[model samples]
Target: MNDIRLYAIGEVARRTGLSVSAIRFYSDEGIVAPADVTAAGHRLYDVHAIARLEFVGTLRELDAGLDDIRRLLEGRVTLSDLATAHLSRLDDQARRIRSRRAVLRTIARQHTEAEQVILMHKLAGMSDDERDRLFDDFWNEISEGLEVSPEFLGLMRNGRLVLPDEPATEQLEAWIELANLLQDAGFRREVKEALHETFSSPGAAIMTSTEMVGVFERGGAILVRAQEAQRSGAPADSPLGREIAGLYSAHMGEITEIPDSPEYRAKLAADVLGIEQMYLESLEEAATSTDPYTRYQSLVAIIDGTAREAAEFMPFAWLSSALKAVASLKDS
Candidate 1:
């Protein structure tokens, strides 16, 4: 005990690389107390206190709150516990930074109005529950008063936008866009009108609304392949393009219980291409058209971490062109 070395505040600062004032602050906060007081009323820290100060400085640099450090030093929480807790906080901070960056980038790119900028920022900061409710409202509004079965309604509601805890910039942007799109009255009206036509028109008798929606969801894989083929720059009349067109032809035929024929293929192409169409006949059209609905599906794909499968209009446009070519060739 007699040989034990004690360090004055200045010496402790030199050894721990902490400012003298910081050391005094820690001491006052009871994070690292002085070992003894000199007769002249000077505070002195022992080697153990110096080590504690060093650790305290490290934690502070890591952005740990003083209360957390106090808990750690007081043995209320283990070092591993402190690290785990701080890691969670760091992750939260990172997510916030990413969200802010996304908002700023969107504003710069769009030259967004002040009101819209506020809305986008608020959308980025929405809680999980708020986001869920937003999605629910979208589905509910679209399906309201429709004769669709409960199962079909449930399917509509099931396509939720779940942003990961650590979302990328693109994902955050997609979420904001999706939120805005869902809130758009024009978008909602279009979707509701399409759903109404699907269920109330003569086509509803051929296949239940539930079955039709199922076909759309199930045909996603085929559309994915068509998109891939289109991206390879294959002309609409090329073999690969024709093959994809045939796949869609068969899928649509199966859905409608009508065999594939030149006449039917021609009509399918026309309906999906929005030519002489009373309502949306294909999910391809709904999700790959020039309308806001297409943007909605693209954003959904991004938020779902399936951006690679997100379909743009060109692919489906190429597809419709191929369908038309096949029909014309068959008739010739």
Candidate 2:
């Protein structure tokens, strides 16, 4: 004891960059006990005590609680173990802080108080699982009684919309909009109607094992030709337009087992136009965002442009008339 050097509380504070009061608090709390008391009544810490106080100060800076520091100092827990646990706690706190910051940023950008509240509530309340379940419910409802292919169904399921833990403002807004759309009864009904019409139409049976392969191959070819014609800036009523329309009529004719006559072609064109209009309207409604980050505009444009090019072929009412015609012909 006589050979060892001792530091007063003031000296310890200066050495460890801690306040005298903090050192005194820790000492009173038995976190870092003094080595001994001098005859004059000053508390003194030995070299080992100084080192322990330094460690305790570091832990405090790392945001460790007093109780946890006491546990470490009392040898109830090893320094390595305590430090590892504290690091994990800090990491969890950091993640939470980041998530909160993301939400706050979104709130800050909101133009209206109602929007802010709604966005905050939505983002804060929904977990990833809950979000996923919402999409599952939507797809299940829309796809009811529909003969969607396994491959296509898988694609739909895999494209489930989910917000990241720390989502960007645009992504959060997009997700919120998507959720709102899913909850819309009118939108659901419209989508269901479209699906029903498409699947129950006359040419729907064209998706047969042998026919489907041919249809897909031919469909791809038709799209390519229409895209080329669109690129060349051909008018919808021009010869090029008729060529695209002819390609579609021939495809529908093969599918419906109908003769490709002018009357049949006119009816096919009408049906095609109706379906195209439905899709364009739906896309426009869903993608009505002014946000540049929303991918809806580009997606809608691509689909609309493709449909317009296909419409150039002028096969208007194919599905409805062909189905009725084929049924009547069968009856006769």
Candidate 3:
């Protein structure tokens, strides 16, 4: 050991990129003891000490603490074990950094201070479980006292509104708007009333069955035709519009077992229009996805369009006066 060549702390620092003082601190902490002391009292490191010092520098780069380094040097922990622990910690730190970056990007794009503050509070502090719970609670309230189909219930539960691990600006905005909509008391009341009325109406049983799928499919076809007519600039009271309207009215009459007379159509239109604002609000909440609210809106639109077309054929005075009175009463 005495005959082995040695390097001073300065030489070790030059080779390993560690400062002389850092080597001294590690030596003082017993993390890497000096191989020998010169007669004049300067510390010297042998080949083994040189290797240990380099290892210590590498661990320090990884942010390992003095105690951990001490344990590693003392053989109390294996290098592999220490490295695995450090890798786990690094992964957690990376996740946190990414999350913070996402939040900053979201804030940078906000149009108002109030929006920024609210989004920061809602999203930055929210956990995955908290987000899930919020959706569950909202659906519970919306479905309360309503006899929804099992399939519909399953869709509600599983169609989660997930925020990505690193959310984009539009996704953040979507989450914020959806959360706000879910919490609006007036919106909730209107949605509940609409659901209640739909499920309790005479046609409710038929509408909730698998058979309703056929009704929706037929209505979707009619809507496509109506959309074509609309794009061609056909007036709502034109022949094309009247043809689509007739198909729609016949379908409703067949499904509801109600006559397609002026009074029946007027009452149906009033009921359907009463829920129009709520349906529109739901569509807004689900604006980013066609599948989210299209089916529900299609059903409402068919009924609404059919009733309005039927009313158009009534005497001008009765159509204007009587329909307005019925719609106002139903809406209230």
Candidate 4:
């Protein structure tokens, strides 16, 4: 009868592979009760105790604390409820892991403990309202004195600061930088005032925020030639030069003019070169600044319209998202 398999605490630990102290801990916590006690008060157990210990180990690995484990062992909480909470926690941990990975990618090297702390705090702390407030401050500063439409005001109102989910290192770094920029009140106010000034100042960029009833055309002959070269494998110099020249041509079409003439081509070349000057200035402002609104406005002015443009500029994904928000609120 003794060799057949009822085991003592030491035997249970040996077979289940739990340490003696851990088994004792579980017993004390009421997670794994003794199957029986000896006449001398030693904990004697049968094989059923081994099964209970196995269940205890499974719950602990899932981060189920002792109280929850005991509740489960006593049949107080359903397995379904436990599983749901455990999975949710795992998903949250995965998101944090991804954010950390992004910080690592941005640094392009290993991070110090201090960097980890700062990066995590910035990337993880803000709620959506907080992020929106940062953008609000920027637009108010930039649109100062400008005759922006209510529609345009709405655009600024609806701008959302998008932080990446499963962030890459670059995204995490960008997020940290963005958060720090938003913290300064004076900087945001300055951004709004500057934006108001830009919209008031210029030949373009402020063309009704959607300058239309104006022509919409692509760059002419030069652009065509450049596009052809892309197919012909010509030196990128000639080809890219043509494409760059096309930008002004496209604007000309939008403005109801076509710059197909050689003289116009020369002017277009000058204009493109002019764009470089703005780019340089924008680079300087962004690098030396602490205001998100200002950085975004500069980015909008310097960058071209493309996929990359949406990320840096005002949230140009359009009224659709905001419109959706309004619709949702109205219906609710």
Candidate 5:
């Protein structure tokens, strides 16, 4: 009997490296069935049972429910699906943790649960749709007689914050803070007024919101790149050898009067390209980094891109409603 592969419960536990109680639990849960019973009514296990128990143990550790284990054992789900589902759930939990952390931080600052909850809700990031709706309403309120363009509307829509529904703890916190910032009456008013400056300069400014926004975004990108490259031993006069600098110059001065001379263009390009390189790096690195300012960075990028278009509409809101579609946005 000792030499035989089949064994009684005690022998099976000894050979499989499982405790008797664990084996019994698996049996009760229908995860592992006993092999043919011995003549003395003792529980016996087949060689297959040993493998099954090991698989079940692994699944349990991975947080699979008993039902999931049963379905898996029955081949109801593929391994890939099982792994994806587990990972997705884990991501959701991580987002919740981030949200909670933000709330806790708020609580810490204010030292009151009531205050924290209030702050948390405002700080929470809104969906793209929510942000769009907010802007839409705000325009409707204050965009009377404004000459908003379709392209301008598109820029605004694109700039809307669309944080992932399930974000990391830090992301959640970032969302909260950003939302709170936007929600601030003073901040919103300042932003609105700041926007007004772009359009108020004079009649026939020779630009739309889209063109304006694109210009600033391009210019900022160039500035970021140039700044970083200069720091990394690339001289300001570094021949525009990198595509980043060339692109920055080409696109930046396209809409603005930064001069068309090759030498001057190259310098402007290098200076601005440096800025863009750094800013884009920040955007790319955001997904994996635990930085609490992810939301802020994204918002800045979007705003940078939209600066020109925003400038176009800053001046007029009571002359014409040709841009009524874009002239509607709600106040925070």
Candidate 6:
């Protein structure tokens, strides 16, 4: 005891690089009590107490709470335990920060409205299950009382968008946009009409889900061919284009069991063209951004991790032009 060297609070503060009041505060808090007190009521600390103050200062610098530091100092919690808890907290904070960053970036890039900024923040922070539920409401709304087969409706429901666990900013933006589209009344009505048209057509009652899928699969292939032809500088009236159009018309005829005759082709062509125009007009009335279909499809692809460069809607556009040419009997 006589050999022990004790220092005043000022010397301890100098040694530990902590402020004198901070050392006093910790001492008062019983986190690092001083070793001795003079008759004058001045605080004095030994080497061990000064070292403990240094430890407290380090933990404080790391943002460890006072209670946690006290518990650690008291042997109530291990350093490893405190570190684990803090790491988890940090991870959660990082996700929130990332979400906020995504929202801010979207607002800046899209010139988002004040109301939409609130919406984007809410949507960007949604859990996977919550996001799934949003789409569930959409599927239920669109499929309710529709004559579409269960299998077809199942296909629609199964195409739910899934964001990655740690989604990128673009993925978050896509999700927000998609969520907005899903909730848009105009978009909902448009999808319902499309579903009704495709599944409630004349011959649809006789077509099995497999048959419908086959027809669409075939149409998709023809669409691919039309796009290829377009890329190769082939006009919509080119021989290859006409061939693609004929295949598409035949498939359309299958939808209604109408024979692939010239009159049927002309009517289908006119109807397709008219519907495209009507769709665009309706989207405008709905206050949709430019080419909402393409944007919607692209956002879905991005969220689902299947994003590709072919979201331009060019396949259908090319096919539409070909259908028009075939209707006019202009197979150049």
RMSD to truth, every model:
8.0, 13.7, 15.4, 12.3, 12.6, 10.7
Q: TM-score of the candidate numbered 1?
A: 0.65
Top candidate (TM-score)? 1
**Can you give the lDDT of residue 214 in candidate 2?**
54
Q: Estimate the TM-score of every prediction.
A: 0.65, 0.55, 0.54, 0.56, 0.61, 0.59
Q: What is the C-alpha lDDT of each candidate?
A: 0.79, 0.64, 0.62, 0.56, 0.57, 0.77
The CA lDDT at 78 in model 1 is 97
Question: Per-residue alpha-carbon lDDT of model 1 for 1-332, expressed as tens digits?
Answer: 35388878888888899999998898888888999989997889988888888888998998899999998888999999999988998888898999999999899889689999999999999998999999888887887898866766665555567888888899998888788888999989997887787679766644556666678776776777767777787788888777778888888889779977899989878776673132224444554666655667767777877654443333556778889989855532
Off by over 4 Å in 5: 1-4, 14-17, 38-41, 115-128, 131-158, 165-169, 183-187, 197-199, 203-332
Off by over 4 Å in 6: 1-3, 144-153, 195-208, 211-294, 308-332
The deviation in Å at residue 246 for candidate 5 is: 6.1
Per-residue alpha-carbon lDDT of candidate 2 for residues 253-328, written as tens digits (9 for 90 to 100): 8878998676676676567658757856655654664432233333323322432344454222333333333332
- Lowest summed lDDT window (length 10), candidate 3: 313-322
Tell me the tens digit of each residue's lDDT in model 3 across 7-71: 88899889878899998988888888898988997899887888888888888888998888888
lDDT of 5: 0.57
The predicted structure with the larger lDDT, 3 or 6, is 6
Task: Quote the positional error of residue 23 for candidate 4 in Å.
Answer: 1.7
lDDT of 2: 0.64
lDDT at 272, model 1: 67
* lDDT for position 327 in model 3: 29
Global Cα lDDT for candidate 1: 0.79
Predicted structure with the largest lDDT when compared to the true one = 1
| Model 4 CA lDDT for position 90 | 85
TM-score of 4: 0.56
Q: Which candidate do you rate higher for lDDT, 1 or 5?
A: 1
User: Candidate 6's residue-wise lDDT over 117-205, tens digit each?
Assistant: 99989998898899889888887877777875676566555476688877777777778778888889998777776666677778776
Question: How many Å off is the CA of 242 in candidate 6?
Answer: 37
- The Cα error of candidate 2 at residue 5, in Å, is 1.3
